[model samples]
Target: MSLDFKPGAFSDFFRDETFRESFTYRNSPDAIRRFPFPFDRDEYMYSVNMEPHVPGRKGSVFEKTFDVDEHYVSEMIDRAKVLADDPLRCQSLPHMTLAGWDTLELIMEAKARDYPQWFSLTKEGDRWHWINRPLGIDHTFTFLDESTLPYGPFEYIMRQTQGDWTLQDERDGTLWLDAGVATSQADWSADFDIGMNFHEWHAPVPLAHDLGVFDRALKFLLKLQHGSPVRRFNWTMTVNPLLDTSPENYPKWGPTKTTLTQENLGRKQHLRVELQSLYRLPRSNAIAFDIRCYLGSFEQIVTVPKWGRRLHRIVRDLHPDLATYKGFIRNRPAMAEWLSKYDDGAPTSPGWWPED
Candidate 1:
């Protein structure tokens, strides 16, 4: 069933939630069960592990083209605040205007078709009527007309959606990071990488270049066709469910890394997962990339027995370089120690499913 958040019936947890200052963000018991656990094995490593973005288990993150859940409204609110503080977070080059509209159409249609109760999109020729009940947005605008919308098409639709979006214009046999909105990222800067090509933007990732991971991935993406989308999972460690982990604001969140202790590690240290999807837009031929972030706390994750066992093993045996790259090396020892209490050395079943 689709979700509904009508007035007076909205849950108090969401209405009073915060992802910053006091940091009251959390997952409901149901949300934790559905958490997109990234590791399918006891160990973790980077690879071009992508698959068709087809619908999966009925209530999973992959069940829809775009997954909207309990955290949708709160995330959009957080995104608005981030953009207000730093407008550069959303950028689209001159040539990316068509790509912006392409992305807007993609998201609006997906959400309207998937969750009709909450979103509705009606098109009459070039004019379109869009209603987004969750965000209290309803407007009729002419498609491809920039003057009809408050912001550029990319920024306009992105503000109402969850996750960070990047539009890549393909040219010269490679994808260019020409446009993007990155409010909820993992130590990356959209502004800094705006004009960078595929390899140039990914140059900082350790060991992946030597492994030829990026080379193969770039080759595959260059051939992506319209109507077909692919997705993969990427994860990192974060402190306190903070979504705005961009390096530009590191000074604000950097010190929190040193604050983790045995008493609070379970609640503060979180496993941040990104469900990255790449879609080949029909009109612009630009690839629309969605980096949807999911944060599950140690306390919530350990509730699943298999998850607890596998998490401890992965953490304790992780490569030192990976730990440092993920910004959790300083707290890895404590995390493993805390998670050990939940793991009894049992051999976890072979997949990431909670039922396993």
Candidate 2:
């Protein structure tokens, strides 16, 4: 199988690098093909041990990354924000504690610390970012053994792009999946607002464009929408087990399989996965779920109880560190230079807004 994609689009992510970090192909270098091509192409398979900072936790993270046909990505983005005011649509998917952020930054930092050249690819401030943006910046992974039953494998489909990599229950061979998880091929802007009623959320940020423009857009959009002068950082990680492909049949993932109507099941490869996205909101934290199947076929939305007030806040020396870390850009001149165009640029008297 081969993946025939727009070679120019990935030129940035495919710069000079160590062969060990990348999986071009096993026997065939052109295993992963792209574009108007007709074949099962290259699939990304990585094992992540999600237990670095956690006291005593371990699990496995196998993921497949793919870009939705440009048109489909736009459609999903529209679907995600169809009614921007809907609480269900605008909530952040993944919410982490300050510790998690530290770990995440540390991981990215390690890549830079080890390979300064690769640092530019992993982090922002590059030519690709000049036009494209970045999404899914925070990635945490661990291993899942036969034990942790209740919180085991999240979801899986035999013939899909994204699946959990696991050892066969018989301990015979390895079972793996190549699935499409997400893409940062667009501008996804969001904000927490207080309207006449309770807190309202506005997610009008354009969520679809060239993946190239995502990182720059995400950093700018996040600060504009969620950053606050009094904004405090906290560290927390929510865990949920959706799929249990283990043979032991442990009481792991309790969520039931979400069955979609045959009509919605576009292809023969259909499997329901209940995965939750965690996010820290101003008022309450959230874990929004989607009984999604076929990677991007369809999704049934679900959520959990909100993280109430009273969670401990970890204070940090944030003023100057904003640029080196989060909060704000250290290079005001660079930032302003980036935001020169008002039509889709920096904050004007009215602020950067969405198209009505």
Candidate 3:
């Protein structure tokens, strides 16, 4: 689990168009090997779909609890580029400074536990030291002093980890999105969502509000425990390999909705699976929503016969409202056709695939 990321690994990754192009293909085995394929049934629906983070899952290339995979360094580099392009992607309210420190401590501890060789943390009195060998970051800072860390406490933590994090504060029996960083949002805007309650933030989701899914989710999130982290998987399709698909950059990627055709469907379309984890900070009474995105194409998905057939059926049968909300109305038909052409006509049942 210990990866030695060279000093310029990220720069090298970004500069190499050929290396980046490798992942954009439909039959990239490397992508499929690590893909968090999100469908389990022919029909997809909204649900609470959370469970305790169990380690050593069989299908995924990385662990479910806290994973640092091959894309760790590259993705962090992508995050930095996005944040530089727009600092608004990372925000923490002044009152949430303490919560920010708590998040940093929690993430550092998790990194050390999961990848001890590459990451470590040590504390002596109020002075704490964090060492991230891969990033060549070694610094000592006062646990709660904003001046000691170059960036906001939460921002500093986000730089070292692969997942984008959001901290929700619990107040008056409700959870509010008080602080955190997000560079890889599905189509939502973290800046616009700040200060909104769980239900308000998820308002755009198709049937969650009508079916009381978000209400039940909010209740479950508020009752989450400190040691036990729960995770759920959500998926959407994007036209590009890029991760910064927030509403702000919609103009850049939004047009791809109508541009997809059977000719380019396999190479242009990607299934984006988000591994979202919810953790209750021990000290701040805040919930940390960590999102890690995994992308794969129909070419790679079809390699697994069941995944191909299931995805074809799901897209073909998806409710119109849900498909529209997911920004798939214009392109899904083309994608379904491409998937069907590649499918091997495998027999699949609803219970065949495991839930994330």
Candidate 4:
């Protein structure tokens, strides 16, 4: 059986006055624009498209090291729901305990510095105080003490932040998936991939491994500097506004991808983009990979004429195997057709849209 999607209902969320108002930074010079639309051209191929995490680079408003967007609270709530339903969605090996602590401290410090109003961290002797104003969480605990944070260091960090993170330890000339919490995965199992080498975990990716992209990425990651982080972009299609698309919940979301048709394409299909950041923790020397998921529907994305047409072109030119790997092969044709409506060759203004 297939799930039904109502275009009117789905479009309402994107068109809501309150929801659109949440995009307060849309016109600001420093506003991190929505839709870091990854396609550079009509033909899409994978590559190690990474750059230094310098703020305001290339005239971009993503001026902060960590991104805390309007969806932070809602996404964190969804993550908590997923973790409660399946504890395995958040796991860290015993060896990664310290790495987990390092990750927690790093993110907390970043959040406190970047968003001082909502998050604050202070230390008095060996005791640390973490204040999450948004969540109404205020607690004092011994720094690095497991008992101090009942949910564990990584899980505690995951609760306050928006993105999912993974700690990678460099050893034996390879990166190991040692620890961290991943609640919003793109059809991948963090629990299953735990303890796997970088290459082993990404073995299923078609040409990236064979083309030595992963090998080169590992080398680049290992040489990454402590304070200087780098970021990259990846994208796929999702059928819902849901964030917890990990393989553990595939039984629930996998069928929705197959349910896409011309009738429901505009409402059910969403362009899911991941703003992936790589940080080298100064303390543990562990590499922290953060995945921040962003979703926009065809209706919202079409507001930006360039993004709409570019997305249509990329999907039209997408390789069959690549589309299949991304779990969208079954409905790519319908999606392409639907996207064509917005590709009327209108002169694009090359500006950002709030909804996108």
Candidate 5:
């Protein structure tokens, strides 16, 4: 497919592919301190699928490397261990989903020229804030001429990609929500694909709720939780990348940050099952769930665990009376039971009143 990048979009100057490759090939260099990151050789790759949100927008395949060192590997594992131990850390939400965590494989691949120390640094916002500094990596990429060498080399270019996610509960075997998004970004850009999610828990004690958090939690549980695990997920794929102003030649596709292209079809899903901690000690230390989604929206939050049953509130796209699925959330049940109950036709009403 023809890329929409404008002239000079891929001018060379990105990083040290030649030098780094030569060093690694000749002496086996182990690590490099790239600003904004410290990567090992293993992390480097030719392609990357977003670990968090949407599918298809998996970003253009890379023919380059992301070299991460053992130190970086240790850090990533250490972080994953902590997130796994805390049930709330895995909650599926925007801020919590893999943001600030993993380097988006394709979305934001800013590398330092040589090392983090050599890059320029200048403050961008508040004093305490980390100023804008060269990530040390340049994004000038060049297209490959496959016919000449049968595998012409490729380079890294700054580009925008869209991502999203949908999470399911493992304990109750029910889908709690469906979250999605489309995004584009430049430097200071981000992409963290966290396998986040929520689970029904029966808290030994109920905690207090201010309006804001209450609304947020309710909104959290409002979507359909139809995912199983990263391995057993489902959804169609939305493969087309958005074309607007871009830094490459089409800065025109630079992303207005005002309007967004819409798509609900073609979303693919992945699911995985793993043992996780599901308790929060801060607020009463009652029962909680470790729900984390790889997409950007969902996050980890403490709530009275709703397990074994599901609420029966109806979900209406328009402004239907019930609007949300409170009854379904409240009645919370194991996924199998919920399916059985709704098998014959929806009752169309709560047990005691007309649901319509």
Candidate 6:
């Protein structure tokens, strides 16, 4: 599915929208069908549910190495606004420059290969020419030369790409969160998390630590070979389609949580899912953790019968601790009650697929 992203050329392929004030963000019908609903069954729990980041059925988020959807352009705009307000949202320690280049290479190559019409890259030894039509970027530079780009390699490419990312440097038998871009994160602080080790950064997560999910995940990631990446899902609830849900700016968005009611809950409440993928860079051996976010309003999600039913069960039965940790404990009862109207006590099929 080639998209028309040429500058100033309007097309339904790229939506013009906002994720901030007057929040006009929405999912098209196609996006709703392909929403990455996290639960496989009627209940939810924290686990190391990692899977191979391989291409899947067409028209699905899993169909590409880095899924680019209708939200691509607008999401990039939102990220730029976030960075403009808080430059610290994107930071790379001095030692992680090589890893940044590695990440830049990975995204550019994947996007050019998977989405040729919108992106193109050509390389001659170390010199590279890259083009991103959607963002109106066209440049030629030495591959590993940081001076050639406007920002660090990681930040430069990340600004053009969707999702929040953390480049983890492995040493002392653990991964270090030395660098990251977390503007659209789910209530986490990249500024505070920087330089923390694997466990240290994940210490805030609730039941996962006691379940040893991180221990096993960290061990598995340490052995992750180049050319083989793993992906997982992490999710929470948000009041609106606002993407910049960072802790630093919580005062701006936190108050909005109190505004939900059964009347507006279907339109305002959103399930924020993170399609997190981990990769082992060939040269630097650093792991690039891509935390891609996908937001679907309750109304958009309930359009699918299976999703509607499963979501009701998951919300109603979700453990209290997980709800509190996810920052939606106050609204869980309202959400569950609202979702129960769509769940007719029918049996849902086995997987996350809506068409099945």
RMSD score of candidate 1 (Å): 3.1
The lDDT of each candidate is 0.91, 0.20, 0.76, 0.73, 0.20, 0.92
lDDT of 2 by residue, 1-356 (tens): 11111223223333321111131111111111111110111111111111112111111111111222222222233223332323221221232222222222323343334334323223233211101121112222322221321211221110111111111010112111111122111111222121111111112222222332334432332332111111111111111111212212223211112322233322211112222211122322111111121111111110000100000010112123322322222322322232222123222222111110
Give the better candidate number (3 or 5) by TM-score.
3
Tens digits of lDDT, candidate 6, 1-356: 11122354435698888898888999989889999998888888988899999998899899999999999998988888888889999999999999999999999999999999999999999999999988777888899888888888998988888999999999999999999999889999889999999999998888898899999999999999999999999999999998989999899999999999999999999999999999999889999999999999999999999999999999999999999999999999999999999999999999899978
Of models 1 and 3, which has the larger lDDT?
Answer: 1
> Model 3 — TM-score against the truth?
0.90
* Tens digits of lDDT, candidate 1, 1-356: 11122333345433446789889888988888899999899998889999999899998999999999898888888888898899999999999999999999999999999999889999999999998887667789999999888888998988888999999999999999999999999999999999999999999888889999999999999988888899999999999889999999999999999999999999999999999999999999999999999999999999999999999999999989889998898899999999999999888889899987
Q: Per-residue lDDT of 222-313 in model 5, one digit per residue for the tens?
A: 32132211111111101112211112322333222222222211111101111111211121211222221121100000010110011112
Error of 4 at 123 (Å): 1.8
What is the TM-score (0 to 1) of candidate 2? 0.20
In candidate 4, what are the lDDT values of residues 1-356, reduced to their tens digit?
11111122212112221111132211112222445666665577889989887785333326677766555555665667677788887888887778888887888887899879777999898799887766667788888788877777887777777777888988898889888577777888888988999889999999777778998988888899988889888889888666777788788777777777788777667788888899888767888899887777776676666878877878988888789999888888899899999787654443333333
Global fold similarity of model 1 (TM-score): 0.96
- Clash count (model 4, backbone only): 0
Model 3 segments more than 4 A misplaced: 1-31, 58-64, 349-356
Candidate 5 segments exceeding 4 Å error = 1-9, 12-162, 166-171, 183-356
Per-residue accuracy of model 3 over 147-174 as CA lDDT, tens digit each: 8878878888887777677889999888
RMSD to the true structure for each prediction, in A, is: 3.1, 26.3, 3.9, 7.1, 22.0, 2.8
- Best candidate per lDDT, number? 6
Worst 10 residues of 3 by lDDT: 12-21
Question: What would the C-alpha RMSD of candidate 3 be, to one decimal place?
Answer: 3.9
Best by the TM-score measure: 6
Q: Candidate 1: count the clashes.
A: 0
Clashing pairs in 4: none
Q: What TM-score, computed on C-alpha atoms, does each candidate reach?
A: 0.96, 0.20, 0.90, 0.86, 0.18, 0.97
